[model samples]
Target: MPRNDDLLDNPRSPRVRAVAKLAKRDARSETGLFLLEGPQAVSEALTYRPELVLELFATPTAIERYDTIEQLADEAGIDVEFVTEAVLSTMADTVTPQGLVAVCRQFPTSVKEIFAAADGEGPKLIAILEEVRDPGNAGTIIRAADAAGADAVIMTGRSVDLYNPKVVRATTGSLFHVPVAVGIELPAIIARCREAGVQVLAADVKGDDLLAARQGGLLDAATAWLFGNEARGLTDENLARADAAVVVPIYGHAESMNLATAASVCLYESAFAHRA
Candidate 1:
């Protein structure tokens, strides 16, 4: 149920302020909740993870603009209420939120749980991130992993928080489509993948040329890709832990590929190779 049926017009009201506070990491940590901003993100959440929605706020103009989202939320039994643009501005992180926002409970799953959800099948493809601190890169990687049909994604304890509002916005709700587990020990995840008979491919400039590996049919097997931080890439210790080092071959003079682009290329290559 809504806090009230009447439109919440006051931006300073306790409820509105409380919801806005979710933009902060501390608030999310304390409340175990986060905000979903813009129509794209909120609509995806409502469609894919409606049960996690706690409250839905929209302006009359926004509801009219995004009729499908409002209808879907209503169909899901979520309480949708009108709020002034002032209230929305106060609640959203972006200057323009596309006039939609929702308060959603954090989705939590452990590494073991992610594997268990695989339903007894050997893990085929997974992406493991080591201390990836950039929210945009982390979220884009999650989206790429999902698109590449990764069974799961593991983020080490030092990686960006999955629930961070910026990360959620970057994922555009692919976060909900994929099984993403955080705070797991990297070595344990690697060990589990090895036990499951999956190849561990670590992405690095020093790794074997990706194109050559693909051409040689070396990437046709089940593989888990380990990607390191944006600035540092993977450490020597990190590379030593994997079965093989992999690199995206660059034909041009570009010094390096963007983190997201590199991961996407590697994942899709594996996807294509496996399907063949």
Candidate 2:
């Protein structure tokens, strides 16, 4: 239960400033915590990983509108602290916090745990992000990976910070749904995938046509799709490390597809083949 009497109304309070500081990478790195903005992200955190949520803040109206969040929070033994709209906004990274926000621990899965093939239960399909600095693209790829039933996502050391607020928001609620391993070097990840018997397939424009791979029965194997930066794609050295390189064919007169769109197509291709 929350105490309305103790409503946080100060937008300039020390606590509010501390929470707002989480928007910066240094603060998040030091505190091992990140900000969860909007009702959707907060609700997902409460539902999927309540233990990681250090604090929950919401406007009285927000709790009323999203009463299920309150119920879930209560069930998880989390006490919601009612805050004024101004206070909520001060603690949020987005322009509009949607009247709810949360402080959650950053839980990054180790690459070894992700590639753990003990008992022959390793991941069949995985997504690896290399030097993917665009927060939106990285997040969407993670969402697409989850939607395609991929086992996990691994972001190379050169990629954007996994705890970036923009990345978290772009994920919607899928950030909570997928296991993401961050900060691992690309070469090490590829080696681990090889040991796990997962073929690393680099998604690059210079690669073999995706249709050819599908026709060759390559998509049905335990595979890890490597996606690179939005602008540059994969470097030649990195591409050479892959078991194979694949390109999603562009059938239309359109110049090019967005990285996330191309990634979804590639991931779903494997998903379809796995089930077929």
Candidate 3:
């Protein structure tokens, strides 16, 4: 397919500079757009949320290698703007550019919509992050939630920005797969979950064993697993908000499990019970 516009070769052009600025939080907030790098992320946005993608840029070599990306872009009615390797590098946040970059609008699902019943279906499984500061952990949890058949994910106001480049990359395209509601407070989430007939279970160190909870049939319900900060875990006040606190028991010598790992286990347990 031939594009009418000239090849984007100038790395220092005003247009390239604007795209590169999306790497910063301020720029993303100001424009309601973020940068999507590599073929994986770009392919996902093109596949799952084509309307959100405003611009697609790829080097001729990249388009040749990832021919599927070009095809997907075409199917989504998005035109791929050809850029030089130098231009891609300038626009990409990574040290090694994957030759494909896209500018996408930040489409965050509202908390109300996440909990409300839609088309005779409401959320059955959800992952709630409270004051989680690490972008990788937050993103990985979203990815894991998607894998575990979670209905949605909620990141508290104190948590890392969901649109951060690191977080977006860590999601590995799951960001588009899952409905994520951001900037919500823990209390608001808990109240909404309860009103929606969902139980709130906190993943806390001082909580009861998860195996015991499963045996007690506690997992056999619509559940929202609340995960706290990586280092400090959940506060007493926040922990009290949940109907129960459940901990992932480590049988091995491993000191502790990462937040994302523990969350995945919890979410899968709920998913299994929901299906069973």
Give the per-residue lDDT digits (tens) of candidate 1, residues 145-240. 989998888899979998888899889888889888888888898888877788889999889999889998878998999999999988899889
User: Residues 1-276, candidate 2, lDDT per residue (tens digit)?
Assistant: 347568999899999999999999999999999988888888888888899999999899999899999999999999988999899888988886688889999899988788777577899999999999999999899989989999999998899998899999989888899899998899999999888889999999999999999999999999999999889999999999999999999998988889999999999999999999
Ten contiguous residues minimizing lDDT sum, candidate 1 = 111-120
Instruction: Report the error of model 3 at residue 4, Å.
Output: 14
TM-score, each model? 0.95, 0.97, 0.96
TM-score: model 3 vs. ground truth: 0.96
Q: What residue pairs clash in candidate 3, if any at all? A: none
lDDT of each: 0.88, 0.91, 0.92
| lDDT tens readout by residue for model 3, 1-276 | 345366788999999999999989899999999988898998889999999999999988899899999899899999999988899999999999899999999999999789778798789899999999998999899999999989999999999999998899999999999999999888888989988999999999899999999999999988999999999999999999999999999999999999988988999989888888
Count of backbone clashes, every candidate in sequence = 0, 0, 0
